[model samples]
Target chain A: MNQTSQPKLWLAQQANRFAPALFFIGLVLLWELICRVGKVPNYILPSPSAIITAFFNVEFSRWMIHLWATLRVALMGFVLSIMIAIPLSIGMMRSQLMNRILYPALIVIQSTPVVAVAPLIIVLLGTDDPSRVLITCLITFFPLVVSTTTGMLETPPEMIELSQSLRAPRYRETWQIRIPYAIPHIFSGLRVSITLAIIGAVVAEFVAAEEGLGYFIQFSTSFFKIPQAFAGLIFLSVISLLLFKSVQWIQAWFFPWSLPKKK
Target chain B: MDQAKNSAYVSMKGVGHQYAPQAPLVVKDIDLDIHRHEFVAVVGPSGCGKSTLLRMVSGLLIPSQGEVSVFNRPVTEPRDDVGIVFQKANLLPWLTVRKNVLFPLKHKYGSYSAADEKRANELLEMAGLTQFADKMPDELSGGMQQRVGIIRALLLNPDILLMDEPFSALDALTREQIGFDLLKIWREHPKTVLFITHSISEAVLLSDRILVMSKRPGTVLDLIEVDLPRPRSSKTINSPRFAELTDLIRGYIYEPDVPA
Candidate 1:
């Protein structure tokens, strides 16, 4: 018989949670040291500490403002995408004529580079929040529509039979059988869209906007505040991460039964 | 009420179907009459269009040639009076076991209330899944999931039950268990059942009559009456009479390859 296992082994395994942050800390320390030794000018290569100080001291309020602006636009675009996508997907599923007419146009919309089109949109719609939101919607809309339509159409034949035999109304079948079956795929598309939304907002801001993380980055570079520019980059990344995580959380919360439990 | 005592509840008149207009007909000249409270089993070899015929009767398919009438009304599309249990459990993975049972009721009633919840709980309890009500389909064993499917079908209190190979996926032990459960439900609620299967024992153990069908361009070859008493069990399987009937059905199914 082996001796009782030490509880410290379990504690050691739990310490894995901090590994990535620790690794990032170590890299930052090494980069700071290298920059100091190399006597790199702040304009050329600001140390990690300088970037952090700039982020905290000078840009905190502006960062919050810009982050909120981008998030608001992105959120509005995402909600609109969901509202429009679901019905369009359902319509496409109900009619092959609708699919034939709309699918090619959807392909064209998805394939068009959002970044290249942002300038054109800004010119057409003016440099307003709506234009930015439109660009965001453009970028994120197709995936949701395509995935949801595919999901609704691909409902298990047996489940369809089950619904049919119940004499379920067409609307009821669409709601209970078709939509619920499509949820997993719909969530997958939504996860992809969350990040695309952020990218879309940023690209639109890059083309035309007086406020937002994209504008902050643009202005910080003009003023030669390289560390503050990097700070803006950090803000954008954090926004992207939070958006992605929020979608994951939403998917998990609403569809607890559908999700595969993690080991 | 007395008229319902004798005539067929479901009558199929010259039903024929094909996958496409140009394709060879899969089910040709099928005429079946299932009386009220009767258990009819359609048995055939694979690809023999037995399942296709059931679909037509259930109104999942429209026959190219003939009419299907349930309770003397044309079955133009699916009706709520009929419940279907598919070969697989086919429960949506996203809904809990109880929710799956409540699915048909939701379509029937169109809203949720405390009453619906109570009924759902009752159905789950009846299915012996009281503890697993919140469990998703993927979390349950295959036999357990199939039980949930059965309960879901019964929740509607349909006038007829259509089953397409409902137990063919289960192991022998599980199949026997479900077969008995089905019989108990049938006894408790006398619905006209049209069950499709390939197993001779399954058809024998459950059906009032077994309709044996021949292969492609499928047609009913024979109708064998199962005069076995009610509440038949595994003990009944050991009886000489049960064995004789089972053997007779088996011989028909595996009849010496008709010199095709």
Candidate 2:
């Protein structure tokens, strides 16, 4: 009975490993079939083949330029937000007064639409990477602050007691104990904020940038080249996914203990 | 000899704690003297302020209406010579076993010396955790992790070891084994241990004296001296006296709930 079940178990494991890729391919194939058979217009919804063709229609250098533009703004904004959010969260964690003061201000900022503020920021900081980066920072920093604060606060009371018993200084306690404890939550926030960074950059580009995937999409749509716009949209998602995965990979590589344990 | 005995290494005088000005007291009118190298266990039902008593001794909690003094000095804040092992292992998962043990030195002083590292390794070796020194806390078993927590408490060579239910999280077999392990360690390197526990048999097995506390607004009910001969093990638990002591504590803590 053991021998019989072994091969069946191996097969199940193999199937489980390949199922996602298989399902994804099936979805694309079905979409392609539906598009072709239904005589779908390219302007309304471009076929997969047309999208791929349009992706390669432009010179590779031109695509690279736009990709670089969007990627730079997104990453710069992400790094900037991290710089601001972490220390802010630490400040908020260390002082009750700061938490009470900052919470309302943060909520106000979060509630106000970034879209409404983007043009004003573009006008204030000018239509450049700095303005675009600030816009992205505005969008991405809130979750980091909230998640980081929650994580730091969520540190076990016993661990806090351990720190207290050691007679460690408040700064050392926050740095060594609270910050390390908050890494998992901070990473979750980073994963969210990194993707939002991309969206924020695109939103900024929609309002002002001369070059970016968002701009390229807008440019293509204006020219009635829907397939080209679809290609640009694909680039946005692919970059967002890669950024998200990199955050997970960074956690796994540098702080593997933060990841949930496997059975 | 009487003066030395009276001048307790650690003393709490009429200690009481109320979390808020209007709130009811958690533990009140408590008085205890833990002599140098004595293993004193405080056993009570859950929320009987057994842990509150330890916190006061460690200087983590300032008693609202009394004083905790160590070696004739009042404890106003966290004392340097008091090491605490909490209920859970509470090992920092990010650090390896060796690093976790060395954490207190680094935590208190931002950096640990080579000598500190050497001391940490020695403590780990003594605890029989030398082989797993580089392994993460997550990689260790619950029993091993708790052992690491104990070793961490011992790392600083503190005069007082404040253990709040250190072995309660472990399974019965592992808890028993660790109890023996703790006895072996205490014999080698003595510290004034104030252990808080909910288990009466545990209190009987490990302590030189047990402080039984009544339920909340917890007050001291009795302090029983365990005259069981030293070098105690599972055999000690099987002895006739151990049973009597446990029965005595059980009666104090738990009235027979069943209709009798």
Candidate 3:
């Protein structure tokens, strides 16, 4: 009975491994059918095949340029957000008064719709990459601060006791115990912030931009370049997925101690 | 008076601790003096502030009144010479057993060198964890992780070790194994130890004297000396004397009116 059961279990495991790829192929086939049968207007909804064809046929350099623009904004905003959040989190953890004072302000900032702030920031800061970066930074910064502070503050009492009994210096305790303890949470916040940063950059570009995926989308839609617009949308999604996945990968690689970093 | 006449390695005089001003005391009017190299266990029924007393000794908590002194000096803050282990091994999951043992030393002294590696390995060997040195905390069993934690404490070569119900989390068999390992380490290193546990058998097996406490606001009820010989084993638990001491301590723990 055990011998037969082992082979059955192996088959079940193999089935699990093949499920996702099969589902994705099935999805593509269904999409192709909907485009063929429904005869949806190309201007409103481009066919999957046409979008894929345009994606590869388009001048590679032109796409690279757009990719560079979005990547630059995303990376810049992510780095800026991290710089602002880490120190703020440390401050909040160090003093309860700081948490009491600044945490509410942070909630207010986070709750404010990024779209509402986008035009205002464009108006105040002027139409440039700085405004886009600043908007991305604003969208991404608060959550990281909140999560990092929560993580640092949530260090287990036993770990803290261990450090205290060791007579560890204040800074060493923070760096070795608190910071490392907070890495999983911080990475989770950063993952969300990274995707948000990309969205923020695009939205900021929607208000005022001569380049970037948002501008490309706008230009394609106005010109009735429907396939190209869908292709641009596809590119934007890939950028987001890549950014999110890369952070997830980093989390897995470095902070394997935690439950797979929160998506 | 004869006990007091012995050299006091660690002393707590009338120590009282309260969580809040309006709240009741957690531990109160506790006076204790441990001789040099003494293995003392503080035992009481649950919530009797046995753990709180060890916390005071470990410098993790400040008493609301009175003093805690180690080696004749008042403990103002956590002393580098004091080592503590909690019921939870509470090891950093990110670190291997070796790294966690080296964790305290790295902060005390800057940088990890060949000397640190040697010390970590030596500690691991002492804890019977040399084979598991490279394993992460999560990878180890509960008993193994606690062993790593004990090694972490010994890595610093502290003058005294404070353990609060450190074996309480493990199963009976593992707990018994660790009890023997603890005595072996204590015999080799010869540090003043203040071990806290709610278990009567554990106290009987491990301590030179067991300080039993009343319920909160907890105060020391009695300090019973275990005249049992050195390096006691799990088998010695069957001995008539061991049974007698166990009953003596167990009597203090149970409420007479409660259903047995």
Candidate 4:
């Protein structure tokens, strides 16, 4: 009886996992039917089918060029933000002076909208790749710094005492005990920052860039090629989702102990 | 003077500590001595700075005034001669039980050797945790986790083992079980142990002497020597002498009319 129920339970679990994807497909089908039945002009709102066709019709090389451009800016900004944020957080955590001096400025920067600052950034850097990357960096930097700093500060008192009692050197304690303890929180920041990096790339491209899916959408929409604009939107969502999942995958691989164990 | 010199493996001379310079002392004028290979348990009411006293002995916290010395060396900072087990076990969640046991060795000896691995395995076997050596801390039950903690402390072969209420978080059955396991381990490999606990019965069952402490601005109220025989078991706790010692320690902890 247990053997028969085991496979049945596994099958039910698999179905449960796929339920959301089935619902999403059903929704898209309903959207396609509405677009057809209402006779909505394709320029106003292309159906899902039209968007897919437009996506495929675009020269694969052209799509690659735009996607590559956006991916480069987003990834560069994300990596730079991580590199800057982690060390800055460590410095901030280590020294009260550094924290007192920089933390208020960070909060001020976070409070000011990136949109308001993007135009200023473009003016300063004059509409170049540097300006675009900088804007993306500025947009994604806050969460990484805040989360990394919080994680470092919140290292368990017991763990700290344990390391101390071990007579662990200062650097060893920071690297082995504190940093490893902070990894989950750091990953949380990375997840948030990766999504924001994509948005930052798009926003920078919308305002200043001559390439990328954001520019593709803006240019296509202005030409009233609504299908192409919708295609670009779909591409952006897929890219963001892929980046987020990659972070999750890396987190799972590096910190498998954090995951629930199989019985 | 010769007897004091021979017996004092650890000595705290009027040690006091406060968080800030002007803050009231959490621990005050604590004078203590533990002889070589003696198992001493410190029991007190809540907020009585038993942990603070243990921290001073381990050199995790430097006392604001006076001195804590181990084997004639004044403890200015954490020394390699001491190992501490905290109340929560505090095993690095990312490390397996064996790696956690080897963590101190990685820092102390710079890197682990094959001999260290062999020793770790032996400690695991002694704790009955050899099967779970590769398992993450969360995989074990609470009692099992604290046993892993005990093995980890024993790994470095420190002269002094400072345990801060290591079994307080376990259920009563597991607590007694681990208590007996600790007794067996201590009997086999004797070290100067300074165990802090709120459980009088646990202190009675484990230690050669139990130091009872007063409430905050904590000081040693009384030191009661347990006349219990070596190789104690669960049955040791059921004895009349165990009851009498626990009752005496309880009186020291509960008597408020005594001046601080």
Task: State which candidate has the highest DockQ.
Answer: 2
Error of 1 at B158 (Å): 2.1
Candidate 3 global lDDT: 0.87
**C-alpha DockQ of every model:** 0.64, 0.88, 0.71, 0.70
lDDT of 2 by residue, A1-263 (tens): 69989999999999899999989989888878989999999999888999999999988999999999999999999999999999999999999999999999999999999999999999999998999999999999999999999999999999899998888899988989899999999999999999999999999999998999999999999999999999999978999999999999999999999999899
Error in Å for residue B248 of model 4: 2.2
Docking class of 1: medium
Q: Candidate 4, overall lDDT?
A: 0.89
DockQ, candidate 1, vs. native dimer = 0.64
Sort order, DockQ high to low: 2, 3, 4, 1
Better of 2 and 4 by TM-score: 2
Winner of 1 and 2 under TM-score: 2
What RMSD does each model have against the real structure?
3.4, 2.0, 2.9, 3.4
**Candidate 3 residue-wise lDDT at B163:** 91
| Per-residue error (Å), model 3, residue A22 | 2.3
lDDT of 4 by residue, A89-125 (tens): 9899889999999999999988999988898899999
Q: Report the lDDT tens digits of candidate 1 across residue range A108-220.
A: 98898989989999889998988999999999999999889888988988877776776667888899889988888898899899899888888888888888888888889
Better of 2 and 3 by lDDT: 2
Instruction: Give the top-scoring candidate (TM-score).
Output: 2
As for candidate 2, its clashing pairs are none
lDDT of 1 at B138: 84
Q: What clash pairs does model 1 have?
A: none
